[model samples]
Target: MDVSQVLRMNGGDGDYSYSNNSLLQREVITMTKPIIEDSLTNLYCDMNFPKTLIMADLGCSSGPNTLLVASELVKSIDKIRLELGNSNEPIEIQIYLNDLPHNDFNTIFHSVPKFQKKLTKQMTSYSSSPRCYVSGVPGSFYTRLFLNRSIHFIYSSYSLMWLSKVPEMINTNKGNIYMSRTSPPSVIKAYHEQFQRDFMTFLKCRSEEMVRGGRMVLTLLGRQSDDPCSKECCYVWDLLALSLNDMVSKGLIEEEKVDSFNIPQYTPSSKEVSNEVEKEGSFMIDCLEVSQVNWDASTDHNPIFSKEDAQGYNMGKCMRAVAEPLVLSHFGESIIEGVFERYTNNIKMSMSKEKTKLINVTVSMTRNG
Candidate 1:
């Protein structure tokens, strides 16, 4: 399957739109807000207050989250400048929001005016208004998109775990959709090699596009252990695989299709990420932090705990938003609901036995000569 063509969060403001179901991503953004603020502040300091700041948010899926990033960044810079008390020389900021071509750029564009309006209001109290330019750049980040040495800072959240494509030789992972405890060494090696290639390409492209001392903050779902098949990393998919297999048993879907289907994603450990950066030789890893969040944390906002399906369904909703397009493209839309329904049931059962959490890895890197 051409993942680039099919991979996208469900679009539009309907029930499954990424906008509504991206609470998990929002939680992630909130968790990493301090890291983002610190990085932006440090980048500004390292660049010596350049007249123009070029920033890009890679894999900026459509929704409030995208604009929130831009807003927070503007606030960070404004805070720094306000402290400096420079009323005469405010910086010009250009933000390029990037994602796949199939992403809902229209939704993001429609929201940009509101974003700009709010930004203007926020800047009114500051000494000088920083001219902010926001535009959508639709493309894959695995390849070069920006001009050479043009960007000063780049940020990505809840992305980069997705591979450019599924491993070319995943025949060994017959019954699984992702790496699992049962997956063989060959399957693990294939995934590791793909991540290395893709991440190195990412570094090389960014190195060319960013000026010296440019910095990047990336947040992705990753494993906490060296083992690629660690439960925290692959358990979700293992449950998903079980759901597919159950469907196959009931004749809801084909066994061969389930066996052949592999998600185009990989969760790397911090060591794995750091090793890649060192090997690429163009970027220096400044900080790497890992945190975990429970699967049911979404329900914290809702006071009345009246539903048994809350936790599982909440996670399922988020997962559906992210992977529904791919699932629909491959299996047809008829089974989408049923698949997730069964998947959530499995999650509900598992949650009773043990708490399931996903690891969030944040890495801060600086460009080197």
Candidate 2:
């Protein structure tokens, strides 16, 4: 499948929009704030208070989360400038918020006015007001999106795991939308190889576009083990697969269609990420932190809690916001409601049996000459 055409989060600011259901992704972004701050600080020092800052937020799905990143970068720069008592020269900041063409760029664009006003109010108290320009760049990150040596810093969160396309040899991965315990050995190898190629391409592209010593911070779901079928990597997709089977049983979806479909996503282990970086030979790793958040952590304000009455339906809504476009592209519109109903029930059942958390890997890197 042409994932670039089909793989998009539910768009717009409606109840099921990515903007509303992406709290989990926001938490992931929050977890990487310190690394991002450090990267910006280092860039400032290395560049000697550069007058212009060019950056991009890859896989930046719409909503407050996209604006949150812009806010953080501007704030970090302001903080650094204030601490150093830098010259009164004005700094111009340009941010390219990037996602697939199908992403809800309109929602992000519409928020730009309010975002700028909020930034203006906050900056009135500060000594300097940085000129910040935010715009959406539509394309696949797997390809070049910027000119060579243009971007000074790059940030991505909860997005790198999506492959440009499904693996070619996935025909053997029947009854599973992702790598699973029952997947054949060839199926596992196909996924691993695909991730390696896609990740290398990502590094290579960034390396070309970024100046020497530039920093890039990325956060995405990952497995703690090399096992492609590890719980941390596949459990969520396994539940979805189970839900699809239930749909098949009830005559809601065709069994052959379910078997034929596979999500073009792969959560790699930290070692796998490190190996690819080292192999690419363009960037040096600064930090590779592994963190975990509960599956239902997006249900409320708090990201942590003892299992109370699990909000399984809410959790399913969050996942649907992310996975719906892909499913709709594959299974058509007929089974959408029934599929999610079964999927939400599966989430509830699994949470009752045991609590589970998704492992996230945040890697900070600096471009090397």
Candidate 3:
């Protein structure tokens, strides 16, 4: 499948839509706000506080998280303006929200009016003509989307793990989608090679598009261990594969179909991420750290939904919002609900054995002059 043309989160404001189910992503964004703010602060001051600050949010899927990030960035800039005694400097902000063409840009565009209104209210006191402009850029981030040396700050969260395409020669990864303990060494090699190529392409494009001293903050799902098949990274997919297998056993899905499906995602190790930055020689890593966020982090934020299976159901819905489109395209919509029901049950069962968390690698970087 052509991921650039095919991949998208479930759209609209429905219950299963990515917009509603993206609280986990929002939580992660909130968790990393301090890092992003600090990095942007340094970039702003180092650039001598450009009168017009230009920035882009790559893979900015449609959701609260999309505008939440934009608002946070605006706040960070205003703080710098205040610190530098330029409160009346009349700052102009240009923001580009980017994702694949298949993403629900309509929802984001519809939400922009409210976002701008809210942002305008916040800047009324110390700033004037500090209006913010937002536009959606449609295309693959693996390729260039902006003019050379135009963007000042870049931010992406929980997005880089998606490969441009499923790895070639991945037929060896039968019966399991994504990397698993059962996947052969060749399968892991192919996935890693694909990630490396895509990531380098990303860096090369961004390097050409960013001014000297510009900053980037990226948060991607990664593994704590060097091993590609570590439980922390692969177990989510393992349980998902198990769900598909359960369908096959019930004769709801063909075994061959289950064998043919492999998710085009790979959570890299910290070493892998750092190695690519060093190899690409475009951005200098200012901070590279790993943190674990529980699969049930959303549960704590929403108190109304306390129940025996809330966490499992919540996580299952979250994954569905992100993964349903791919699953629908591959396996048909007939088995989608059944697959996730099994997935939720499997998650609850596993959580009983031990609590699991997503190993997140958040790296702050600056363009090398």
Candidate 4:
């Protein structure tokens, strides 16, 4: 599958849309809110604060989380300006919402008027209620998206875990969608190598675009353990693979096709993340945190619905939002519903045994001169 062209959350406000099923992502954002506020404070106080603040949210997919970040940023800048007694400076906040070209930019644009109205209502009397210009920039974050020293702060949420592309020459990890305990060391190495290369390129591009002392806050799916195939990181994919294999046994899909399919994703450990930042030589890690997030945080389970089944169904919807497009691209759309139904059932069965969660890492960095 063409990762850049095919991978995106389900667009619009449909039942399965990412906008509707992104509570887990919302929790991640909420967990990292303090870090974001602190980073902006440092940007204003430690560095020479720019009257024209240039900010970008890389991989800002279409969802409430997209505008949530922008809105919080404007509030933070306004608060800092008030505290610094620069309320009359007339700050110009230019927020660039970035994602792949195929992302739902229209949905985001449609919500702008409401977002602006809400933002204006929140501004205090002391501040000039900064003028915010929001625009969509379509492209990959692994390559340059802006000119040199143009951005002051960059915030990305739950996006960097995706590799630019799946690793090359992995003919060994058969029947699995991601790294598994049964995967050979070569398969593990291949994924880590791909992640390292992609992450380095990401830092290089951001380094060129951010001014000296600029700050960045990125939250991505990751792991706490040194093991590459930890249950925390791989169980969700493993369950999905199990569902696919079940379909194969039922003669619903070709075994060979299952063998060839893999997700273009990797969950980095904290050490690996810090090592990359150190190796890239462009940014200094200010704060790095790993939060263990429950898989069922977004589930809307009720007394009428079995808790385990409801949680599984909600997770299925969440995964369907993010992975359905890619799965459809590879397997044809005929089996989409059947695949996720099996996936939901698998999750239900597994949750009956034990609960599973994901490790989300939020890293704050400052551009080094």
Candidate 5:
């Protein structure tokens, strides 16, 4: 149940190469822009109109999304500058992009030159001098990742729900065999416990790292309801089970091994998220919203796959990428490739029939005095 181990199963490298689908890019950019603007305004207010500020993009993956986040920040800064008027004093803007130690730092760094050029082009409209610095600080978000009170604004996307490791309970022999995806009572409880522990730690660490009144915006996957045992929950453990079943039937995996495998828990409710923040007593909630991500957009456009292959492949690949580590560790690597292949084909088939989507939860908060 080690979450890091599961993450490593997907090639251990942090460079998750994603295709640049214009529609998907636009969707994420639109979702984040308002939150970024609101957080910046609150941060500016908290700073009492400071001429300079610092911001960090926590859990920033190497992709077009990074540039989108930076663009949003620059626009926010421009709005602030327009309100303040031109002055001899230059505004100091420091931006830190953070992620796991194993992430592709080279790709992220290589993109900086292009980002700077883009920033320069965008800033031409503004008359005032603004000094901006962007750098990478690699580490886990559960621990202190920055200097104390150094950040004014923080943004993280689609990354927070991943606990540092899998829940310990799931690893024990007494744990239910179906704990990974099924809504077993013991499995649900164990997941909740781990989530609370990890989330509280996140709040405590951020509280210490952020200056009083600093603002943060986070968007990640979440459940529709607060109930932990609901069948129609956010993480869709059943779908995973279905995909695993396909693998077992193909003789790529043993049925007995699949019985003991557990999918890492997700689907944290808004109430759960709020309670964690309040417990920390340092952050004031500004906004919380949940929306669906168009995960099946590609499928809707593709007509090549057979129905069965389409359904199995699209969902299977999406889930297996995250679940493969668990499968490999428990069942061995001999059958993993075929299992994944079947699952991917299934997902593709599913996608051919209808569009698929991912549920997302967004929370915006500011430090309280």
Candidate 6:
């Protein structure tokens, strides 16, 4: 399928549309802002010297969160400028926001004015004039992203789990035949292998693109436990199963087909991701922390029980959002509306039962100097 077709099949519109600014506010911006800010601070302290920094935000879906990363980078650069006593000199900042070509660049482009306005306000607070340039580079993150040794800092949020493409074994009709969530062990294994291949390529490509001693802060949807079969580890799988079951019950799809399907590889545990990073031998682990995020707090003022609950909640919605298009592709447009309706209802049910919430692992690493 073409990029546009792939986008449409994935619920690229409707709830997943970039115009749904509230998702960016509640889902991406609030969650990513502090992490980016804090990570930038950490990286700044470790760098031996400050220089013109080129930063990239991978998988920067069109929304307010796109600007949040840029904002944090500019702020961090300003802080670095103050420390160097170079606040008087114009500091050059290059910011690249990346995503698939079909992503809503118009929304991203439209927000540039507001983002600049915010930057203008913030820069006015600083003692020196900061020269900041922002550009959008559209492409996949699984492959080469930048020029060799070009980027100083890289940040990606909620993007890595997507495999380069659906696994080839998904269509085979062994005991079970499926693509992402319901296939047999071999299918799941194939998906994981593909994930490993794609992830390693991503790291290796970035390693070449990043200057020595540069840092990357990546937050991805992940499982708490090492076990791949654990419900917490596979919450998205469970949700997809629930949604598929509903489709079958409604006679929209075949039971055997639904049972055989598997989801694209995701929910890699902290250990799994760390192992891959270590094995790749391109980066030194600085900090790897897997904690749950409180997404309910974004909606209500009340504090949640644990980080895992919040993360599960947030992740569940994100999974549905990304999978919305897939469902449309497998099923038909008529079922798209009901699919989301049921999918969201399931998320609310899971939340009320305190079953799952948004969870993620934040990893910060620097290229071996």
Q: Against the true structure, what is each candidate's TM-score?
A: 0.96, 0.96, 0.96, 0.97, 0.82, 0.83
Clashes of 1: 0
Residue runs of model 2 more than 4 Å from their true location after superposition = 124-127, 301-310
* Model 6 alpha-carbon drift over 4 Å, by segment: 1-51, 124-127, 170-183, 256-261, 295-320
Candidate 5 per-residue lDDT over residues 205-248, each given as its tens digit: 98888988899898776767666554435424545566668766
- Per-residue accuracy of model 6 over 258-323 as CA lDDT, tens digit each: 544445546677888898999999998877877665435333222663544444444445545566
lDDT of each prediction vs. the true structure?
0.86, 0.87, 0.88, 0.90, 0.67, 0.67
lDDT (tens digit, per residue) of candidate 1 on 1-369: 898999999888886688877777888888988887787778877888777999999999998899998998887888877776655787889999999999999999999888988898988564477878998898999999899999999999988999999888735688898888887788888898999999999999999999999989999899898889989999988988999999999999999888788888999998888889899999888889999888776543444544556776667777778878878888897898889998878988887678789998899998997
Badly placed stretches (over 4 Å) of model 4 are 301-304
For each candidate, how many residue pairs have backbone atoms clashing (under 3 Å)? Answer: 0, 0, 0, 0, 23, 22
**If both were scored by TM-score, which would come out higher, candidate 1 or candidate 4?**
4
Q: Model 3: per-residue lDDT, tens digit, 288-341?
A: 988889888755345665554678778888888998998889999889889988
| Error of model 5, residue 68, in angstroms | 2.3
Better of 3 and 6 by TM-score: 3
For residue 254, model 1's alpha carbon misses the true position, in angstroms, by 1.2
**Most lDDT-accurate candidate:** 4
Q: Give the TM-score of candidate 2.
A: 0.96
The residue-by-residue lDDT of candidate 2 on 68-143, one tens digit each, is 9999898888778767777476788999999999998988999999998899777744446788999889999999
Worst 10 residues of 3 by lDDT: 299-308
The better candidate by TM-score, 1 or 6, is 1
Given candidate 1, what's the lDDT at residue 264? 89
